[model samples]
Target chain A: MKATPARDQETVDKWEVQLRKGCLELAILAALWEGKLYGLEILRQLESDSDLIVSEGTVYPLLSRLKVLGLVKSEWVESEAGHPRKYYALTPAGKKRALEMAGIWTRFSSSMGKLLAPLGKGNK
Target chain B: MTMADDVQQRDAQQSMEAYLGRLRRRLRGMNDEDAREIVEELRSHIRDKAAASGQVTASGVDAALAALGSPEELASQYLTDDLLARAEVSRSPVRILESLFRWASLSVAGFLVLLGSMVGYFLGVVFILVAALKSFHPRTAGVWVLPNGADDFNISVRLGFGSAPLEGREVLGWWIMPIGLAAGCALVMLTTRFAIWCVRQYRKSRALPRG
Candidate 1:
């Protein structure tokens, strides 16, 4: 007996989910690297810049966790159109973490790219 | 504004409130102020998301809520994250275990830490109990290194009945009380410190899906 393609795809999806979970902290930290942004703005930055589409509810808990770790800080500012919005900014520690994460990601992905280079050619 | 848009706005408001209501219910046992603040922040996020889409239609609200995912899961993540953060600093055994048990539900590292914690605390408790029983049942409730063979031995610590189960001499007759008490308290204190250190490490390493 052999596994189906769907099963293989399921395994890949599981890996994808875990990978995303691992990168979420780094991603949020990176999103706040430029300056303060409200929750929705952060989500939009993640989507537009990185093409990573995270579910909306996931970001809040993650932000809370970052604040607990002293990596990020937040404050509420009045919005002209609606309710006051909570804006998140990277703390000094968060900026340091973001730089460290970026370096790691760059190194990891570059090697990953080298490993994956052959598969892209389809020469075999 | 058209009457149709008015109706859609009202429906959107209802759906958002209903979602928040379920979230508030899930957060009931949490600190009221913290829970209220969470609800407030989420309310603002949802409204901000909906309004930013250029229309406050029911579908816009639906999209916002959908992006946010289920309120139940969201609330649980918030609770677990808060618990683990508090557990890192809290010195109380009950509070630490409460946090660890919840963490255990989510990760293997947490379960292992919790198992270590339980075993450490259990031994500490056993030592204290043996110390107390030394006064009541001096014949049985004490620690000893009973000789098992000519070259080997067994270290035994127990709370028993009748006569002592050992042929070898007891470790510390009446002095066992104060020694046991001190040793038990020390064990407990050391376990607490070790558990806190383990939790801090776990928090540092395990940074994914606080749910």
Candidate 2:
């Protein structure tokens, strides 16, 4: 039996959900580690660098939660566009945590890659 | 406007306003201009989508929202990972403690209320009977009052197995016992109702789609 378009879309959506759930934190941290950025700038950076599709909704809540935890501090900066942008910077603790997360992510991805290696070889 | 036109216009307007309201709330503590700009950008995107679709439907609103995701998650991406970690840690401990306290307190209070009501009902019935016998017989009054009163008497009764008093009067004044019983019933009813409301609110909040 052929998979319907809706069923295929549902499968893709589930995969996207899992992917987003797993890596969203790491992606956000990596984006902010470089320099202070506003929400839009961060969104743009994530899309450009990792091809990770994130919604504005996901980013905002995570930021608030982070701020409450005292990991990141935000400041309103006057912009040329006449809007004061909220720029987020990593605290000292944030930087240390980011490094740790990066290490963990590297180990996890490499392990997963190795596990999938057999499948790719078998297909070939 | 025609009925269809009116409905479509209203829907588009409502959707735009709702998104803007959410965006504004999400961007609280940030600069207002930044928040407004974000809202405008989202509004324009939603309008464009609505125009392309030609008719406003629930699906259109959902699609527009899907494009935006939830405001909370959008803000989260701008936060540092350490912040997320801290939030996860800070929130869990406090919430767990709070829920634990709430459940424990409610359970104890409920048990006390139930026990108090049962005791109150027995006392109420006995009081009415004693008051009846005292007024009617007058002769066997001492007999009925003394022995029956001993059982109904809420003096501190120590059980052999327990360290605490098994039976005791809550109020010092015997006259106030009825009032205390009424108050206990009221307290239990109010607490049960509040607990139910809280459960409903929890369920409702959970039912909401998260980002």
Candidate 3:
């Protein structure tokens, strides 16, 4: 039926949202894993580097939560044009957590892939 | 600046103000420090976007706002992690009962330790009954009835039936009340420590990764 495609799309959209939510922190930590970036610059970097393009509102609140949990820290630094901007960088604990979580994700994803491989082959 | 440019800048500023106001209102439950930090970051983000686009106009402001998401969606993300964690813990009936037991024990233990007397024991028993009842029937708030004074503190309740009267009482002397209270205090402390350990183990199991 015509409703089937719409239902499928809705499910896919929900999955996409969940996937993004699950990995947003990982993406942010990965972005900051290299160096400190101002709030806007982090957004730009994420949009450029990956498929996980997110809104400014989304990133700021996440950053605030990370800061509250002591995983990230921010500082106001003068930009090239002389205005102050808040720059975020991972704390040592954040870096440790990121590595741990990434490792877990890698193993979990691999296991999922293996589990789904037979189904893919069957469809093929 | 030219009049047209001035108008454009005013439009941009007003849009930014409205966006920030929405954000502030949506984040009402958030603590002040975090709310202020988020608001400032958003403002700076808009300014940065505007500067990058080479002019501050209504369109540029709108673009920046769009990139940030609507205020409701944005605010919801801030609370999602905590809400998810709580939901995860509450998924199992075992966990819910565990939490209820923890609540009862901690309160009773606290009362026992703080007010080490017959009155404290009476109140603690009442509190535990109330908590257990509320857990089973969430809408009900259990009540306690006690006699007027500590000396007449008879831990008893009598309910009359059609043929026979049902009565419950702790038929112990007033002098023995203090000794019982002391023993209860010690038992509560020991049991609380053990309960906390068991709870931690349960939570650890719950938090374990699933295939």
Which predicted model would earn the best lDDT?
A: 1
DockQ of each: 0.24, 0.19, 0.21
Residue B58 in model 2: lDDT: 49
Categorize the docking of model 2: incorrect
TM-score of chain A of each: 0.92, 0.85, 0.86
- Evaluation by TM-score, superior candidate among 1 and 3: 1
By the DockQ metric, which is better: model 2 or model 3?
A: 3
Residues B120-151 of candidate 2 have per-residue lDDT tens digits of 44444444443344334332321111122555
lDDT by residue for model 3 (A16-92), tens: 76677668889889899999998877877888898787656557766866776778999988767546789999999
The digit string of per-residue lDDT tens for model 1 on B64-130 reads 8887778766765676677656655566777777766755655576678789988888888888888
Q: What 10-residue stretch in candidate 3 chain B is worst by lDDT?
A: B202-211
- Name the 10 consecutive residues with the lowest summed lDDT in model 2 chain A: A56-65
lDDT of each: 0.79, 0.54, 0.61
Q: Look at candidate 1 and tell me the lDDT of residue A84.
A: 86
Q: Would you list the clashing residue pairs of candidate 3?
A: none
Error of 1 at A6 (Å): 3.0
Which portions of model 1 show Cα errors greater than 4 Å?
A1-3, B2-4, B87-92, B100-211
